[model samples]
Target: MNVILIGYMASGKSTIGRVLAEKLNHHFIDLDDYIEKKEQISIGNIFKSKGEIYFRKLEKKYLKAILENENHVVLSLGGGTPCYGDNMNLILNDANSISIYLKTSIAALVSRLKNEKSKRPLIAHIETDDLLAEFIGKHLFERSQYYNLAETKIVTDGKAGTEIVEELMATLL
Candidate 1:
């Protein structure tokens, strides 16, 4: 089975994905890193050079490819992956996979992402805590529609990584 973890930036998709994969003994594929390797460019550069439309196309193709090509893998999707094209539909329709939304509060998200904004292109231009909070509040509200479609949702607020993993394991079982 493929375990797909979906969430907004800094919601711990990549970090949790790694630990989950280790526990499950499944390969962990971080979608952004996968795309970077395949395209031979950073996701940030891809956005700058090729634009979001092109990046979304690539994201769709690879998201599909990875699901089709492997089983027993933990795949962590980018923040916007489910919001683009028919991607959420594709994820929902897969029988061999289960998608989990790492639901986090906007306050928690802002706290997690503020220091990491430079690494994330979409919010890199944002300045100050107030601006970051506003941006995240709006973005999370918009993105929650797609995220809520996940088969399972895990609230990650104030929870330790191992605690979240334990919850995930319980849900999976």
Candidate 2:
């Protein structure tokens, strides 16, 4: 089965996916990292040069390719992957695939992002709490529809990695 992790940024999709894959003995693929590896450029650079539309096109292509592979994997998708294209439909059509949404509170997300702002190209310019909240609010509003399509939803608010993983395993098993 292909386990797809979808949620807002800093929701621990990649981190939890890595641990989940290890425990389940499945291959773990972070879609963003996969794209970076394939294109040999950072996502920030992609947005800076080719623009978001181009990056989304590439992301859709990569997602299709990865989903077609037969190997069992835990794929952590980018925040807006399902919201943009036919990606959500493709994921829904796969019988062996299970989508898991890591739901985190806006406050928690803001806190996490504040600390890691420098690493995130999209939100790097957001310097204040008000601006950060506004940015996340808008993005979350736009993406929630796609996120709710997940087969299972896990609330990750104030939870540790092991705790969340255990909950996810229980749900999947």
Candidate 3:
């Protein structure tokens, strides 16, 4: 079976996916990395040189390809992955895969993302912790609709990666 981990930026989707994949003996794929490799450019560069719309189309294309071809793998998607196109439907309806939401609170997300804002195009323009918090609050509210479509939801506020992996294993088993 495949596991798809979805969440807001810095919510540990890629980190959890790596550990979970090791435990489950599954291959791990960070969709952004996958896209970067295939496109021969960094995700940030893609957004800068190409644009979000082009990147989203590529995201959809690659996401569907992975879902169709891979098995026993953990796929960690970009923060906005589920919110675009029919991607949420694809993740929810796929028979061989389970979609999981790493449901992080606004405070946690702001704390995690503030220092690393430069790395994230979407939030890079956001200045000040207060503004970041406000942005995350509103963004999470909107994205939660798509994220909640996941088969499993795990909160990562004060949990370690190992602990989160255990929670996911329990659900998957």
Candidate that scores best on lDDT: 1
Q: For candidate 2, what is the total of clashing residue pairs?
A: 0
The list of candidate 2 runs beyond 4 A from truth reads none
Better structure of 1 and 3 per lDDT: 1
lDDT of 2 by residue, 106-169 (tens): 9999988888887888898888987998999999998999999998999999889999999999
What are the RMSD figures for all models against the true structure? 0.6, 0.9, 0.7
Those runs of model 3 whose alpha carbons end farther than 4 Å from true positions after fitting are none
Residue 171 error, candidate 1, Å: 0.6
Model 1 Cα lDDT, one tens digit per residue, 16-86? 99999999999999999999999999999998999999999999999999988999999999999999999
TM-score of 1: 0.98
Give the TM-score (vs. native) of candidate 3.
0.98
Give each model a TM-score. 0.98, 0.97, 0.98
lDDT of each: 0.95, 0.93, 0.95
